[model samples]
Target chain A: MAIKDLPRDEYLLKGHAACPGCPITVALRIALKALGNKTILVIPACCSSVIQALYPKSGFNVPILNIAFEAAAAGASGVSAALKKLDKTDITPVVWAGDGGSYDIGIQALSGALERGTNFIYICYNNQMYSNTGIQRSGATPYGAWTTTTWTGKKEHQKELGEIVRAHHIPYVATATISYPEDLYAKVLKAKNMKGPRYIEIFAPCPPGWRFDMSKTIEMARLAVETGAWILYEEIDGQFAFTSYSKKILEGRDRKPIEEWLQLQGRFRHLTEDDMKKINSHLDEKWNQYKKS
Target chain B: MKTAISLPTLGAMGKTGTWRVFRPIIDVEKCIKCWRCWIFCPDGVISRDDYPTIDLEYCKGCGICAHECPVDAIKMEREKK
Candidate 1:
């Protein structure tokens, strides 16, 4: 497909209260632009709920349902079901939720929707904390990161949300980041056209929450992917194939040390050499498991 | 003579954005003493005395110091442009 197919009229507009470098807003904008105007959003009580705002001033150009904290997937499923009842055929329902909403509170509803093979796009913008609730540590938070609940640094437990979603045998499951907007847009667009449930976990950077600079939002995302803190790959109905694996990163010829990425954001500043070794081993284990599967 | 610092190879943007040299210019007039920046800095590259000084050796072009300036004191403008 040509690049023009990505479209230009962004559904998520420029003015919103999101911090200067909130990558969730960027991912939403890119995803909506790719998904086009024939889309409806179900947002839970997370950063996007506030970012979308009240009745008339939503950042979204399309229809948006301000769902409850734990009902984004269910709300989207309900919307899809109601549309079918009304004989509607063309619109795409998108369930957008934060890390806390998806990885913890909304997992049951999400799993139910996926199990029933609901035709909807589930996009989880994982900034790894309950950011809107004052940056408390959540199930998605990485090891050695400092949050309000983990001021001494998070105690080495990060949920494998991607693998858990992949277990549902959705039509599509992918890990993407705002650092790769084109890839992110392309995946969301592909998910839009697919017939069954689609799940995309986007690693969005939260500047205020992560204690990062507004300008370095994209930098952090890039680092997250490069350092293997975040993995980028795609699975089509459980058929795993990594699309963005470059010669350098895969072959290790031109790979910059992962530390280059981590040293940029202060969230990982607490990571000592010992801690980093453990993280490396953890990521390697996850990667090898995916390969074996 | 100092060895040159290389560009980040993480390439999460898939080789999209180019590394244009950026230099931070801090306006002393608008300088806020809160230093939310110095506290959150990962690299210890920004040296704060009266105003913050960016030591390029450890500065990875993340622009955290420039972006975290609560006041309009620090500006991260393109060096060549």
Candidate 2:
């Protein structure tokens, strides 16, 4: 669907504490529209917790419970259980977390929740690093990208959180970016209709963390998908399928060079040609595996 | 140090327009009424019906609307002292 076709209902509200062109804000706005008012958000210690605004005056019109850094999944599970007992199953319980919470600290709780077949939506708005904590390097931080903790660059490659979650054979698992709002909206709508644990990892770019122009937030997200650095796909009932943008790339469409994506951000400014070559080869290896799958 | 706990006043704080180094100016003649600016504005300060109107009292002048506008109808003008 086109951008104009999106629902005009604004649940995120104005006067939010998010920075200019914050992709997470945009992502939440779109996702909440799809989920509607009957949604209860369980957010952990992340940007969302702070950006949701200070107490009683929440930026979100929906009910949100701010839990501990590692308790989002568990919190959502409890809420879902209570709602079920009260015969309010129509109210959707969702966990909105960041990369630090999802890929790192909260993984154990998330794993347990998914293992127990908790019915809720868990979305990790991955900005690549611990953006809320002064841009420290996290497990999701990409290799050769500088962070406060990784001054030179993270030596290791980024973790495959989507594949890790998919291994659980959950009812649904998908990867999306803020650039594709329509795709994200559709995925949220699809997940909302299904039962059991659902996970979607969104590549939400952070301007301050990634060291890029705030105005280029959408452009950066689009470049990541267009360059094939970040693939868009979904796994359902043990089957995997590439989404609209990634499907074209999987069909042998020439992706924009990785250099174009890398050069735009200051975090990758120190990378040498050899470093770029290594990153490119790593991407190619992943795409080759996708083709095989 | 003592900490104070209180309910948030919710947008009760002073206007954020003072924080802007650049203020957005909307050109009605050039506007095609796409509503992109209204949807993408981080602060939700833009209101539209027929043409877009920016509420400068809350607009942080993020330039997101200006950048996202297909017709470039919104321009960021330097904030005058």
The worst-scoring run of ten residues by lDDT in candidate 2 chain A lies at A52-61
TM-score of 2: 0.94
Candidate 2 on A192-274: residue-level lDDT in tens? 99999999988888888999988778778889999998989988887889997899999989889999999999999999888
**Residue B34 shift from truth in candidate 2, angstroms:** 3.8
Query: For all the candidates, what are their Cα RMSDs to the real structure?
Result: 13.5, 2.6
For residue A24, give model 2's deviation from the true position in Å: 1.0
Instruction: Assess candidate 2 and give its lDDT.
Output: 0.86
Give the clashing residue pairs of candidate 2, or none: none
Question: All candidates' TM-scores?
Answer: 0.76, 0.94
Model 1 lDDT tens row, A1-293: 43324454545433344544467766776787778888888889998877654433454567777779889999999999988888776899899899999999999999999999988889999999999989999999988888989998898678978889989988899889876666787898789889879999998888888886667776788777766667788999778876564313554534446677767768788788888888778777775665565
